[model samples]
Target chain A: MKKSYITAILLVVFLLTGCWDQRLLKDVRLLLGVGIDYQKGNKVIMSSVVTRNLEKKPPELISTTGSTPRDARINLQRKLIYVPDASKNRIVMLSEALARKGSILEVLDVFYRDPRSALNAKIAIVKGKAKDFLETQSKDNPDLTAFLDRQIVTSEAATIVPDVDLQSIRTGILDPGEDIMMPYMGLNKSNVEILGGALFHGQKLTGTLTPGETTVALLLANQKNKQTTLTLPIEKGVQMTVNILQSKRKLTIQPTGQSLKVSIDLQMNAEAIEMPFGDFSDQKTVAKFNHTLSEEINKEADKVIKKLQAANCDVLGIGRQLIAHHSSYWNQIDWNKEYPKINITSSTTINLTRNGILE
Target chain B: MGTRQADKISRLELFFFILQSVIGIGILSLPYTVFSESKTDAWIAVLLAGIAITINMMINWKLSSHFPSANLFDFLPTLLGKYLSKAVSVGYIVYFLAVAYLVLLLFGDIITRWVLPRTPVLAIYFLLVSTSIYLARESLSVITRFCVIVSIFLPVLLILMLVPLNSSHFIYIFPIGQTGLEAIFKGAKETSFSIIGYELLLVIYPFVKGNHTQIRKVILLSSAFLTLFYTFLVFNCVIFFSSEELEQIPEPILYMLKSFSFRVIERIDLLFLSIWIVTVLTTFVNYLFAASIGIKQLFHQNDHRHFTLAAGFLCLLCAEFTGDRFLVQKISDFLAKASFLFVAGIPLLLLLIIYMKKLRWHGR
Candidate 1:
């Protein structure tokens, strides 16, 4: 009984001390956002926002730049009134210029190597200079990092413009025949706006897609959302706003002797939000609107497809589909050499549900 | 009856013991393995494998019912010829030892990479060995009672999965049937590896002190719980990452947990991983116990203490000689393939032999 009592006491002691490596909240500094850029003479510049202002007035933003992200982080440590741990950092912003040079791997090494770095943190590419976008303050939200994360979640836009988190970027860079895309943020005076999508061929930034072009990219990629809206032109002067209610896309790869044929089927349920010059009450007009909308969306989708084919981006992962379905044929043919010349057919079917609150 | 008295365990305790045995080190990598083969349709493979495992479990239980008070050790010789039974028992013992080694390697690798890079590998090995040996030395009832206490944290682990819910990309799992049926079927084989440890039921059958109906309920409930848990985790990884991403990551659950941040806590994966250490310890203890039990059965020893120590020492030696992570992974793959013989093929053959012998006796 005495031995059992002693054993029980020791076990309790061990359980009480639970995690010996536990760190209290007060002992660590929380980094909410990070930005990296290359300066004029072969120097690295980095800026980070610490969340010490969570209690202060309008959340203070501290800006620091150094020759490297690590160096800039050390510099921030020296300048800050309180020490902060960058391990909890949530957002990493890269300048378009720096991204063009393909140095994101270097800037991101700290996050990748550090065990405490959150792998789920959001990653974005800033248009022009990343510093300008990172420095932009929101009027209502005190914490810029939380505000930016919220915007990405709520928008759910259909573009190659995905909110590239750390896990996705890491996987995209590591995997074969797959590339990563990040949300493009541009600074307009004092505010930061999500411009479009930045496409990458491997880790290097290849090109940017405009918002209109991104819609087609998203549709082709089968990433369309329920809230996505499309605009249709019925005639030269008439226009209508259509909200996408449901969308489904299927990619089929057909073997034609020496070559492979790609076919895409797009099905959508849409409703007209505004009928500028057309009578919505007429079934015939609705049918005409549906046909015109289908044609316009298909035409827009074709232009993006042509551009992607020309660039060989494969952001739609059509090449992956071919490899998945027709592995033997895909291996026999050079995707890079044949992708530009392969025949692609885009088919669209649209069903118009209602004509807004007015109709 | 003497054997039954030595190995008796209650039905509820057996349920928790089997649950821990099935869930172990496999949960961490099953998602990656399944996804690498099947792409987005990996969840379907998990469902199929779950059904297959249930069928396997039913066969095993029925075979064990042939001798109500005996286990695999006593019944196998009657089913197969005596020499074949001994050969098969030796094969199973080696498989259990390999399981112990793989668990040690996996546990060591995770600790070195995630928690303590500077700590020497030997120290981690020692800590794990001591904890597992201490648990193995306990009686069957004691082990099950302790496991029941630890199993309470299993639900907590499930709740920790909700953190990834904040960042999941639902579209990542879209166009599910794009990978075709062949790829999905191939992936089901990988899922079967994760569900392999349920065959522990073959050894623990006599320890179960319950009505025949209750025993069936326990096994079915354990299988259902494991299936749901595995499917939930695989879905989490699938939705949390794209098909390409899931293929690249070795430990998707660890990577997914690293993404979460609460106002009070940062780097919750570290905390989550520490909890996972307990799970690993429980699994190692269970495998060690199984291996020791096999030894005792073969040698006809009443006391398992000496055999347990010897097994733990052998596992330690194997872990020490494993050298590097790459070789350890090679050994792991080898064991996964070899386990199919003991886990699937042997049991089916045993059931067939038992059924044929029963028919001949009735005809005579």
Candidate 2:
């Protein structure tokens, strides 16, 4: 009788375990990439790239419109035979028009509120309609999501854009003293390319940086990736290319009489990757080369700083530094109005650490 | 020695028991809760709360050692007489039941929301309370043994917390002490609620076999480790998220873990939550066992086995009423306020009475 009772209990356990929350892979479609565009009459257009099976078949691009992102997703789900699961989504793109409206947090509220939404999806702002970028196909890679994601990631590694994601950008967007910079993608024929970066004052897109200016901005911000190469035009069109190996930035905010004096000191160690005009064999020549490069970098960095101040984007977190070290001063001034009037200066110093295989 | 129980736990088992009991669902939202009062200086508040809990633990130790073989309920009547002691015993039982109910409620809420939204919360409660009932029916030695085995996951959780520091900005906690000492102290007051389970020492002291010095050292060491562990986690969350972002997220640790997707593991938060369920179970079992002991003492029974199932049922039933989010928050705040009175106020008052009674006896 005891053995019979034990067998019955084992059978009950097997029959009753995990029947409610069992999500099978075959029953759901994985939505890998999402693109949000602002439509007429304040409607939202959501374009999703859904894959039935990632390895076996290519993904399909579907677009739906509704009042909000979740509403659009519900519309998108109704059309699909299987349920769309966004837990594995890797990228989320916003149109420049939608991003400019400062409704970024509103569009992303669903992702943050839903427990199953992916938080690490790469976030970007497209120059035109985000649906166009999502629909753009390539000959080499049929999956447009993977194609665009790889391009943004590669540009991030090259120090041409800031590595901002849905999770990483939330802090910047929410913080009063800081701003966010997202990778800006532009469509070129059948291919997509990361142009530079879209700068946001808070949640609104204020301005943008050119690719060269983006590298300089990121370098001065002390965010260096694997390969930060700079091509500087010297006198008589003698252009030189240098790869920045290491970078350090220091922000000092001091009270000068009535106002504050902000100075950004940027130091970098670089290697001459492709400089046919200069000789690094002599130490003195290398020193002069370093001086010349530093002078040019300082000029370019000054331009980037001026552009940032004009756009009211504190990408370098100078305002954050003020709030941290100079709270007394921070509380007194209206940072938004006073930011343009502040005396902010930057100086870059480049040390030629290596000359590559050449001397 | 004559008052010792049949199953006496060693110094090590006693250490794990105290350590496991003090940590539970509180650690997940600790940073968010403390950040509301102190902002970036929340880690300091955690340390202050740790020091206060240490002092409370010492007072409980001194009171328990005086009646070396008598647990809290066993010696209550000797100090307060039959009626007053019985009333206090009932209060203590109610406190234990409330704590168990909260743990089970929060466990079911988190699992249903995070891991299995489709799974019925009643099924989750059944799985948790049944396991707790099974282990709580055993002796103290078996429970501590289970606690010791589960403590291995604590280090794994620590390692997982370190991953978010890759993108952390330490400058977020700058302008130290900007919130002022008053706010910091208030933050400490807030954390005293999360650091609630140290009172278990009053109940388990009689069953632990050790010299007075060893017992005191073990208790102090466990509290110190707990304080440092909590401080590290809070510090990690503070630096990982900006002050504004930290205020917005209720569970910063889990949210921070959710952002990291490694090659092999897609969702680290789910893995962390699954492991965390075990710690929550251990904490629930600790409270269940304590309540059952109170029941045994009230009935004058030698074995606590009869009341374990009853106490588990009582907690499960109480948890069903707290389905509303606002109600959950209300009960949590009420429990925090009640914790100070039961865990510290009454225990200290009991010790005072014991001292006065001893003085009269000696004078005679």
Candidate 3:
């Protein structure tokens, strides 16, 4: 009888403390990706894709219109069987129209304010309608999130796109000397491909960066893109592909009176993938080829700098370095106005380690 | 010799008893507070504060040694009259209640803001107070043993602070002495409250199984460790954020971790808060333990356990009175000012008075 009484007490103890926060696995819909697009009359159209299974075929899609992203999600709650959980979100896409307007900090702040919201979710700006990119299917992977994630990872490997998550992007947003540049994704027929990057002056998207220009910016920032390939036109008809095995950059800044003299030193280890017109094995040809490749890299870098200056983009974080190393000079001038007029130059030194199996 | 129950606290338990007593909630906002005044030189402030606390520990050691068998309550009447001693004891009891209440309010606020938004502040306060009372019912030896077990987990806590270095910048600590000496000292003054918990030694000295010299060693060692621990945290925070960015977020350590997440854990700040809530609760337990002992000594009460309930009631009442952050800050400022009398002012004054009385005896 006493043993039964002890058992009863133990059972009561277990029954007394209920799990108030208990969430069942089956009762929640996990949002994988969210696409934000602006409509006429300043309306925001939020489109979300909820992942149902690992097979990735028949997931749920919902689109709702509201003044804010939260409002849009709240509106979407009416149509879902379970609560929409964005904590598992892998990516967020902004339409070119919304990005061009550039006042997207408000839309992005919702993700930051909530502790449960995904801060590391990869963000991309569509070169066209974000809904189109979301609607399009990838031939290789049926899962759009997995497909887009792979594309982003490859782009970062090639140094064609920056490897910044939402948290890293927050630094550029809050920081005055630096600005954010995100991957520019676009729909190519049915497949959404990563084009290049969209440059931003704070939260407002300034302009687009070409694929080649993206490589120049990445190289200038010393962001390692080991597998990056540079294709050059040598002697009119002969084209050569130089696969960069490793790369590094050194940025030097000198404030002279009212102007800033900036020089970028790019050092790279590369291999000639296709040297069809050159001699099989000649030292003189290799010397000339190295000089030619260095000149090509510098030329591309100069063009990228010009475009960056025109857009007033401190994408290389040069302005931040100035603030850190030379605060007096940084305080003397307005970065936005002075950045476009700042004199900048670049020089590249490439050591061609190998010329492929033919060599 | 100490009572057999008092003698149960070993040398290691003695070290952790002081260590756990000192390292409470002060660490949460220590970096931000020091940085606000001294900027990048906040780590210097942490080191200086450690020195000041050690000096206080020396004075406390001198007094406790002067009266070996007696705790602060038993000897205060010998130094001052019975009425004055009673007044001082009541003041300490009130101080402990106020401090515990403040910690309860802070615990409730952090949990509400970061962990459980739906739970009422009263519920959180009740939970903390109830746990502290249950633990406070135990003897000092039992408490020290429990504290030793808790202090063993300090390394794990320190390791969690290191995870945010992946995205941190080392350049923030450069030009380290840019702030003037006055600013750094003023910053040290800002850290007085975080280092306030060491005063528990004045009450628990006889309870510890050690000679006076050994007591000083434990106190100094705890002070040094706390200094290094706080300095390490402050220095890491200074490195984690830019000089200007550190000012924007009040809790640099939490903010730094908020931006970082591991593969298995998303929102590492929440994980940190879960562990940190225990530290906050530890602070609550420390004060309640101190206050109950004060009650037992003052009234010659047979059992101190009853006073734990009374203390918890008073703490709950104080916590409930604090309805908003503005009021809490005001109360915290008042307590920070009042802490000087309890920690340093009274101990040093007692030492001076006793030394003067000794000189008179020698002259006679």
Chain A TM-score per model, please list them: 0.87, 0.94, 0.91
Compute each candidate's TM-score over C-alphas.
0.73, 0.97, 0.90
Predicted complexes: DockQ each: 0.19, 0.69, 0.27
lDDT of 3: 0.79
Worst ten-residue run, lDDT, model 3 chain A?
Answer: A13-22
Alpha-carbon shift of residue A224 in model 3 (angstroms)? 1.4
* Interface CA RMSD of each prediction in angstroms: 5.0, 1.7, 3.5
Q: Residues B1-364, candidate 1, lDDT per residue (tens digit)? A: 2454755888898888888887778888889999998888888889888888888788778777677778787777777778988888888888887898888888888887887666667667767876788789777778888778889889878998888886675555656677788998888887886677777788888878977778999889988998889989999998777666677678888878877766776666766777778877877888788778888888888878888888988988888887777888788888878877778788888888877887999999
Residue B338 local lDDT, model 1 = 83
**For candidate 1, lDDT tens digit of each residue in A322-344?**
65566677778777677778888
Query: lDDT by residue for model 3 over A254-298, one digit each (tens)?
Result: 998988999999999888888788763888887788888788778
Say which prediction, candidate 1 or candidate 3, comes out ahead on TM-score. Answer: 3
DockQ-based ranking, best first?
Answer: 2, 3, 1
Model 3 segments beyond 4 Å from truth?
A1-18, A40-42, A53-57, A137-142, A225-227, A233-235, A272-281, A355-358, B5-8, B175-186, B242-248
Docking class of 3: acceptable
Which model scores highest in DockQ? 2
lDDT of 2 at B289: 96
